[model samples]
Target: MNASFSSSSSSKGMMDHGDQPHVLAVDDNLIDRKIVEKLLKNSACKVTTAENGLRALEYLGLGDDQNNTSNVSGLKVNLIITDYCMPGMTGYELLKKIKESSVMKEVPVVIMSSENIPTRINKCLEEGAKMFMLKPIKQSDVKELRCQLMKYGS
Candidate 1:
C-alpha cells in the first residue's frame, strides 16, 4: 500500500516554533491512522501518517537504498507512533530499523497494540520503543504523548 501523510494546521495559530511537534504515525488501518491524526491534531501537533513500516521508512527517506540514509534533519520527525502489528513489518521491526539508523535513531518511537501481552510490551521497550500503548488511543493518552514530545523536542 502507498504511504500517506497529513499535516494538521488547525492549531497553527496557537503554536510557536517550539510548540508544534512533528509526528509520524504509522498504521495499516485507515481508521486507526485517522484517529491518531485527529488526536495529535487536537493536541496541536504537526502529524504525518504512513500505511506500513516500509512506507514509513520511505517517508523518512530510508528506502531500499542502504547507502541513502534517512535524512530526517530536514523533516524533523520528533516522534513516531506506530501500530505494533502490521502486515509486513511489525512495529518492533520498524523500531529496530529506526534505532539502527544513524539519522533516525534519535527520534523517539512509540508502539501501539490491541494485545496486552506483557512480553510484547517489554520486548518493544527493550528494542528501544519509548512507549507501548494500547490500541484505540484516547484523548487522555495525547496529554502524555505531548509531554513526551516536549521532552524530545521537535
Candidate 2:
C-alpha cells in the first residue's frame, strides 16, 4: 500500500487536528471491505465497514441530527464511501438518504463503481457526491481522495 494512501498517523508528533475523520466504507463484498479497511488502517485513520447501505445508515443515524448540533448521543460520520451497486439499497439510494438527513448531509460522499455510467455519475453528482472513483481500487486513488478531503478542511 502506498504510504500516501494511509490516514494521518496519530503518533506523528502533531496536533490532534480535531478528531481523526472516521470513514465508513460500505460494500457487500467482504474482500472489498477488507481491502479498504487495510488501506485505511495503514494510515491510522479510523474506519468502519457496512455490508449494505441500510447498515451504513444505522451508524450514520447514531450521530447528531442534520441541524449540525451534537445530537446528545454520539459522533457523526466524517465521510462515506459506498459502492454504487448493492443488493438491498443501492449506493445512489444511500446517497439520497444521507442528503435527506440533516446530520449526514454535510458529510462527504464518494461513489465507487465498476460501471461509471454517465447518467449514474451525473445523478450522484447532482445529488451531492463529492467525487467518484472507478472500480479496481488502488492506493493512489485513495491518496487522491485524501487530498480532496484535506482541501475541505483547509
Candidate 3:
C-alpha cells in the first residue's frame, strides 16, 4: 500500500475512536466494575473503572494532593457514573464534590445502587446527578446514557 493509503486508514481509525464518549465508572465490587465496563463498551463508550470513591477522586484529581494529580487522565471526561454505596466515600459525596468543582461541575454524573431507596435517589438528583439508576444495569440502561453523553457534546 502507498503512504497516503496507510495514513488515510490510520486517520479513519483515530477519528472513529476519538469521537467516542469517555465515561469513568466507580464501583467497589470487582464483578460490578467489570459488568459496567463491558456494558459501557457495548454501548460504544470508552470506560475507565475505579474501585472506590477515593480512587475515583484521585483519577479526577480531587484527592488530598489535588495540585499533583493528573487532572483526569488529560482526557475530556464526558460523564461520571458511580455506585452509591462505596466504603471510603459514598456516591452522594462524590456528586457533591463534582458539583463544587468549578471546572468539572458542569459534567453530568449518574449514580447507581443495588437497593432502590427513595431518599438516596432524591438526594443524588437534588445534588445535580443526571441520573440515579438501580444496579445490575441492563444494556438498555447503558444505552440510555447516550443521551446524557450527547448533551456534553462528546
Best by TM-score: 1
TM-scores, one per candidate: 0.88, 0.79, 0.86
Best by the lDDT measure: 1
Winner on lDDT between 1 and 2 is 1
TM-score of 3: 0.86
Model 2, span 50-101: residue lDDT tens? 8888777766663334443442225445678999999988999999988987
Relative to the true structure, how large is the alpha-carbon lDDT of every model?
A: 0.84, 0.74, 0.80
Q: Write the per-residue lDDT of candidate 1 for residues 112-148, one digit (tens) a residue.
A: 9999999999999999998889988999998898888
Scanning candidate 1 in windows of ten residues, the lowest lDDT window is 8-17
Candidate ranking under lDDT, highest first, comes to: 1, 3, 2
TM-score of 1: 0.88
Cα lDDT tens digits for candidate 3, 1-154 = 4211001112234445577787888888889988888888778777777888787777777778867534556766789999999998999999998888777888899999999999889999999999999989999899888877887677
Instruction: Tell me the lDDT of model 1 at 40.
Output: 89
Candidate 2 local Cα displacement, residue 8, angstroms:
14
